[model samples]
Target: MTDQVMAAIDGSQFSTAVCDAAAWASLALAAPLTFLHVVDNHPQTAEADLSGNIGLGSREHLLEELASLDEKRARLAQEQGRLMLEAAKSRAIENGVAEPGIRQRNGELVETLAELEDDIRLLVIGKRGEAAHKASEHLGSNLERVVRSLHRPILVVPEAFETPRQVLIAFDGSKTTRKGVEMVAKSPLFRGISCHVVMVGAEVADMRSQLDWALMTLNDAGFEAHGEIRAGEVEESLRSYQQEHAIDLLVMGAYGHSRIRHLLVGSTTTGMLRKATVPVLLLR
Candidate 1:
């Protein structure tokens, strides 16, 4: 809805990748970039009421000490957030972002994203955060919430940065992928890249026709358009297509119809993300 790319920064191994992806999205969309760092809210400890309840006892002294420690921890967190933002801004600038905006807020990340949703054209984030930095089998804690909470497109960087050469869009002819088609057709985001639009189960009554219409739409928008109709499992089919075509970026609708079909969790999107070696551009 807005003309800015929002990049969420957590001081994890994936931070640099996120910044690079944000820079890429900003350039592609020809929009400003904003790097956001969230200093998560910490709940109240047993210190505030100590002065009253433990009336001049040793317990009060210990509680007051704990309170001071909590204050120090909060200060350290603020400083760390500032440093992370500075580093992310530097990365973005180095990756061709002209001038990037910085926003450090104190709250939950999802709530912060919800507040800024209306001003975001694209959201860039890491696939995992520090809490899930296993690099083996962990996914970001807030990935699903952020995807479901925000309506704008999200560019998720899994590994290090790679400039996208060819884009593969996994289409199902659903409203979501139709929206993706409209986005590619009307927006500057996929402007100069070749697009391969593929639909699984094209033997269905209207699937082939739908793919044709999508191809026509992309052709009209000046894309080097290619379409494929494959009959196989959705996630595996898409992965094979991307690999066969040597695609660098994977674009698709965020999920299917029901919450049960979410991509971020134990759904088809999960399998795709697990097997995908490239970055994902997810649209809802």
Candidate 2:
């Protein structure tokens, strides 16, 4: 089967960043990119029922007005979606990416993204929704649900990131880390790029040997990767490393421990997302 990269675009400025990231990956993998825009079904007004207190004729008029507004909103959303897709396609062509396919699906974001996972090598999404609060660093509810449910790797791009140069891979010998490493090793998108494989945790007896094994795996796959072993909390070490290395992208496994453990101890993935200044590639 042909591999594809699926990018979720909602016509926001952040959606443009998502498209750019997806375009880069598409070129790297020599794969097709599919742009998907989901039309959310949630009603715009929760107070529509309150309008019923008026006279029957007025209420009927209000209902008609709401219906007309909804239609106009849907049409505008589709037009914006088309414009964004066209701009992305033009950029891709300029960057030597093949013609990309675009589609507008009418459904919730999470379900649509999950349903498209079978053929997608990577899913690119914005870090926040269009109307998210400025202070929140977390993904919007729709993106979060997709991240938790989809089985593929997700690349979350913030609003201001332009291009990715240096990449940091958060390593700890877990299955998730291994999977992330494999992706980097096999994908052409990371080829000839400077990559740092970081292992963070308290000092262990076989840390050197573990690092050696990880390095060997990358070397065997023809990736020029350097290893670093740090003694501290995972999140703290990651932040320090990013600043020191000027990392543009952070690649790691999503929440290595069990849900119960994560609830009690918190997760490094969530911590990094909230604190780090770069984009994150999280493998599930």
Candidate 1 residues 18-52, lDDT tens each?
88888888988789999999987574565454455
RMSD of every candidate to native, in Å, equals: 3.3, 2.6
lDDT of 2 by residue, 1-284 (tens): 24798888875668778878888888888889888888875668553664545887888887788888888887887787678778777866776777888878887888887777788888888887776655655546666567678878888888766567778998888777877787788888788777888998666767777778778888888777788999887788888988998889999787533557424113677777766567899887
Which residue pairs in candidate 1 have backbone atoms (N, alpha carbon, C) closer than 3 angstroms, thus clashing? none
Instruction: Provide the lowest-lDDT 10-residue window in model 1.
Output: 257-266
Clashing pairs in 2: none
Best by lDDT: 1
TM for every model, in the order presented, reads 0.89, 0.90
lDDT of 2 at 70: 81
